[model samples]
Target: MKQDVDSAKAVMRELFAPTPLQHNLFLSDKYGARIFLKREDLSPVRSYKIRGAFNFFRKALAADDPAERFVCASAGNHAQGFAFVCRHFKKPGVVFMPVTTPPQKIDKTKAFGGDFIDVRLHGDIFDECYAAAKAHSKETGALMVPPFDHPDIIEGQATVAAEILDQLPGDANPDLFIIPVGGGGLSAGMTGYLGGRIGNESFVFCEPEGAPSLKESLTAGKRIKLDQVDNFVDGAAVAEIGSRNFDALKSFAADQVMLIAENAVCVTISELLNVEGVVLEPAGALAIAALEEMDRQSIAGKTVIVIVSGGNFDFERLPDVKERAMRHSGLKKYFILRMAQRPGALRDFLNMLGPEDDIARFEYLKKSARNFGSVLIGIETKRPENFDALTGAFDDAGLRYEDITDNEVLASLII
Candidate 1:
């Protein structure tokens, strides 16, 4: 373990220095506890992924008969890291990404690898791209640089834990460490290293509720592939936890893993962006959101470290981020209302709104050949309690409505 850590440090130094471990005064004051952020966002790739990528590249290159070609499938930070490492090691790489991947990510991956990496836009989903990447590797005899799962990658990621220990004052360990899990490389690596060194420190793993890969895997006592996944939080929206990662994390108590709602994570993204001018991608905000579910008493005075995984946020999606945040915070809601087609009916409904209520959206879904029109109404309010008041008003006014906020199918289509 010590030799592996030393190797990772030596390899990492060849590229860049360690990411900052800065104390977050704002968060500390807000939570009434000492809070520190492991600024993986400051890495050369703007993510800790480079650590694993470099480690994998170093180990592979050091082999007596190393493969000259490296391949990987990713549309996010991992692709960029892999590309960078391939270029750094003077190895050719083919990065397969879903065609639906944002152009920004594609450009970044290319920029990082220069001429050494080839970006292939494959199928519409990650699974499709992953299959293509694997098949390509088998056919071309190139080494597949797995995003996580691989021992070399895990060892590389474990360097983050070592850095945290070194960065702490007098080798002081954090009382609690909150880590975001995707394919589980980062979580598995940190836990494997830290669990070995400081067996007593508490660790909380955070995953998107829509893609609870790690949580589900642990519960099933095996790595189970999810049939469907919500990719809103793309960084941590893995359908299955990596097999190797699951092996490291499977022993953890179920309560140690926290599943955060996709929209709820958006709230943290917005908060960090607006308050601290810190741009955190959805997955990057996972660890911070877990703080809300934690027992205040348990973390009251303890030093806590939250890994801010990445900041490769696309600002063009700001409106979508704001919408999700509002919904999660209960400041916004959607409902299907049956409104009478009378002239004064709309006016009456508008008058029913409370002082703090505002209508953000009002669309007529259907009105042809009907006495009552189907209206899709979205409302925003200063407080969540305002929804109760609004509902009471609807009852008194003889308006019929159905809240479709929790209906995944209905909300996906219209909300």
Candidate 2:
């Protein structure tokens, strides 16, 4: 495996140099540990994905019967990487993305492939798009470039670990490696490469809380497809771990996988952007976000490596990202209140709020009766505990309100 990865690394150099492995002072100081970030986001296509795509394409082209065309399905990073590889090899390719894929990703994929690729908008979700891509590959005899399931893809991704081991300062091994898992390609490849060099206990895998396919599969002793998935963390929101990828990961215990909330990931994204001026997509933020969830005592004096997976963020989503971060930090909340329709009612409610409390949203549901109305209110505050005092004041004033901030269904419907 190491030899294969070394060969893959050699192939990778033909395109782009290895991504940097740098110590992160802010994170190191915050955790009281030596923290290093494998900046895969710095790759030519802004992700580690390019490595796999390049390897897959290189091997395919060298085969006795080279494919005339390539087809792939992806909503974001993978598609871009595939497109970039196709353009580099001057091969015709087709990329199928979900109909609901963000325009920024679609545009970037098209831009990467230039005239070498065709972008097709397929189903509303990835599984549907993947099926369509597969059908097209079968119909046209084009080679299918899967995101993370193939052996060549796995071998290509292992190059990341090779680079890490080669680039670690002073050649000192890290006590822990926090890796983010989506389809399990990168984690599987890294673990496979580190088989002889690093112990299994040294690895920690992270996945979005809304999608725990790897954890579930490990628990079931087999691959388990999730019935539903939250797409907020789009890069890592896989419904099922790839079969081959799962085979590489199934040996790990289920408890080894940590699930991070979507909102928590948003908080990390906002922090990295605001404090470090480092832009990361949600999946890219996973490893860093896992640091907050780890036991400080266990990691305080350890050397840790976190993989920063990708940086293909769309700036247009910044407002929504900030909103999720504030909500996760308990600095913002939504409420449903029954208020008198008469004049000065809102003023009275405002007066009850603490000095630091500010109304971020206020809307009457337009279901007003003769004397009362239903109101949707969102509040932001400097501290979370201020809400206790404000709510106490509301109670004392005989106001009727429901704290719907944590109510998923209610928030989805109205907030």
Clashing residue pairs in candidate 1 are none
RMSD of each predicted structure: 1.7, 1.2
Score residue 220 of candidate 1 by CA lDDT: 78
Q: Which ten residues in a row have the lowest lDDT in candidate 1?
A: 193-202
Separate clash counts for every candidate: 0, 0
Candidates in order, TM-scores: namely: 0.96, 0.98
Q: Across residues 169-232, which tens digit of lDDT does each residue of candidate 2 receive?
A: 7856689999999999999999999987888889999999999999999999999999999888
Per-residue lDDT tens digits for candidate 1, residues 1-415, read: 6678767887689898999998998888888888999999889999989999999888888899977999999999999999988888888999999999989999999999999999999999888999999999999999999889999899998898888888988645578899999999998888888876555348888999889888888787888898888888889998888888888888887778899988888899999988999988888899999887777888887899999999889989899999989988989999999999988989999999999999999999996935899999999999999999999999998889999877879987988
- Candidate 2, which segments miss by more than 4 Å at Cα? none
